[model samples]
Target: MDSQPPSTPPSQKHGQTGNHSRSHLTPEEQRRIEVNRLKAKAIREQREAEEAKRIPHPSPTRGTNIGTGVKRSFASMSSPQGPATLRDGRTGAIHTNRPLDSIRPARNFAKYVEYDFSKMTDTKGGFLTEDDDPYNKALYVRDGKKEQKPAHMTQKEWDRHQLLKSTRRDDIMVSGSKQNTCCECGSLEIDRKWEEAFGCCVCSSCKEKYPEKYSLLTKTEAKEDYLLTDPELKDEELLPRLEKPNPHKATWNNMMLFLRYQVEEYAFSAKKWGSPEALDAEFVKRESEKKRRREAKFRSKLQDLKKRTRVEAYRRNRNGPAGGNFGDDLGSGSRHVHQWGRAQENPEIGMDIKKCVDCGMEVEELEF
Candidate 1:
């Protein structure tokens, strides 16, 4: 069977046989029509070019279709409109945001007028009066020009507003700890950081004068040198640590800083270790304990080594074949016999134990 001829696509067919009336036109008519189309295109392009020149555009364009070179968002394209309220489609009630605004502006007053049966009607509840109004008088709503409270607030609300204002950080004194003179020397200026955090109103020179007290210690140093625990270090009230960003890692927990003297004081306090002498005693004890543990571990390792190693049986080769040591045999042509040691009573087994001098082998003999 023969295959049918390849079918042309609808788009291709439409394109090839476009406008049957136009296709039947003479060459002169077609030329005139094409000239008109070209003229129209030219005029459109000229108008667009003029518009582009008249309105300045940003550099590096978005598209030629838009006058503004920058891409315009959908929100920017729409006109700026104030908020408007319309009736809810589900309830057919006026929107809560603007109850009066939802109604269309008209000459009819009845459309805008709304009523609440609970307040306005004289049957169900009662006729509403000025006493039924929720809002109070708007007189004391403001204290001062800037301290003005929001409108329609109660006396209690206005009092709360003033109370909150009084407690503001700007109004309250943050720090009144003024000490101009240094505690150690008679210097006028003291170290800002030391006085603020460490409660030391001393100059940098005085801080250097007493290195043992004022010297800063790292968290690790404090723990190792002072023998303080994690819980003790974490106690802010007790230790009063100064936190700083970790120098090694930005993401890690902040590094805690403490004065050497403070750490020493806490470590040697009555609640802690009592005194430096007591701290020294504890330190020594820990060191001795650590040494003991090391020795025990070493001894254990040695025992393990002994257990893992295979012990060879003691064999004394005889001169029976004339290939053994001459002194190894007690007599010619014979294997050497084991020389036993003095007998010791083994009370647990009720046996007399004897060991050979050469091979270190033991023998157990029961006696009546």
Candidate 2:
């Protein structure tokens, strides 16, 4: 048998064969190959240019490491240990690293300089020194001046001053106390109940004496009294005046005056419409009837709303998992009972049934 030729390696065989095969191609093929070669070369050069642009330039001072033979532009020098070996450029003198206070001037330097005052003059064309005199030196008129008591105060003056100060102090104390005195008896005693209700103070004795006037009367009663006294007022004007009671300045007298004004105004308007007393009675009756109807309607709507809310809550709990119905017992009526009964009859209808981990009983389990 003839010895087989040595097998060619896969890489070398394909490379060499490809080159040789391309070389024997037609003119068109050769041109195509050349064009492809140039395209690849251009692409490589373009990539190289982009990479070079992305790199940053090296700093002059912060050059390559010392071992790389690269040198820095300037050397970093530490502070000198003793007197500086530098000199001042302008003065051409040696400069030392001593504290500023320790530096001494040259012997030839002048110690003092004098200013010429002979040519100086005031704004009025008078010599500046013409007003100066040895006997008339500048005096600090305001600096030493202070408000001081007379060196010798008379006994009468002292007594008057003390009396004025004591009176001022007493007035301040009285105002700050905010205590009300009864106008009738000039007594400091206050009726707290009357004050709280009417926002005004009146002594018990006065209130007892004038029952109809000061006996903790309601705003309505006061208004009626005012209307009885002045029966020619209008409601349009009266209502606004009655509504705006000044609580801060509200004394018994002030409140009564306001009520009286409201009633008088209402009566005047009522008289224009008809008999003042008859019109007032009719108005009261109509308002009371309207109020009753409104309250009844509100109650009916409130009940319906509460029922609808309960029905919605019941529906939600019935459809959801049994374990999440934690508040089912909080609802009222047979609806809640019926839901509980349904849940018990079909335990697996709304939730998964699982064994309890602790008690090992068949219990409803929630799926997360």
> How do the residues 172-232 of candidate 2 rate in per-residue lDDT, one tens digit apiece?
4575356666756756665653443335456878767765545333354544543333322
RMSD of each: 28.6, 37.2
Task: Summing lDDT over every window of 10 consecutive residues in candidate 1, give the lowest-scoring window.
Answer: 312-321
Return model 2's CA RMSD, one decimal: 37.2
Writing each residue's lDDT as its tens digit, candidate 1 over 1-368 gives 84656566545556677777667899999789899999998887667655644655333223333344755333323314311123245454332233555645657665453556555435444544434443434323343554554444677978975776455434334444543568677675566556556666678887888987788999899777778899988887788777777888878888889978878888888988999899889889999999999999999999887765533111333223223332333343556477787899888987899876544567887666
| Candidate 2, poorest ten consecutive residues by summed lDDT | 70-79
Which residue pairs clash within candidate 1? none
Reference-based lDDT, residue 236, model 1: 77
Off by over 4 Å in 2: 1-273, 313-368
Using lDDT as the measure, which candidate wins?
1
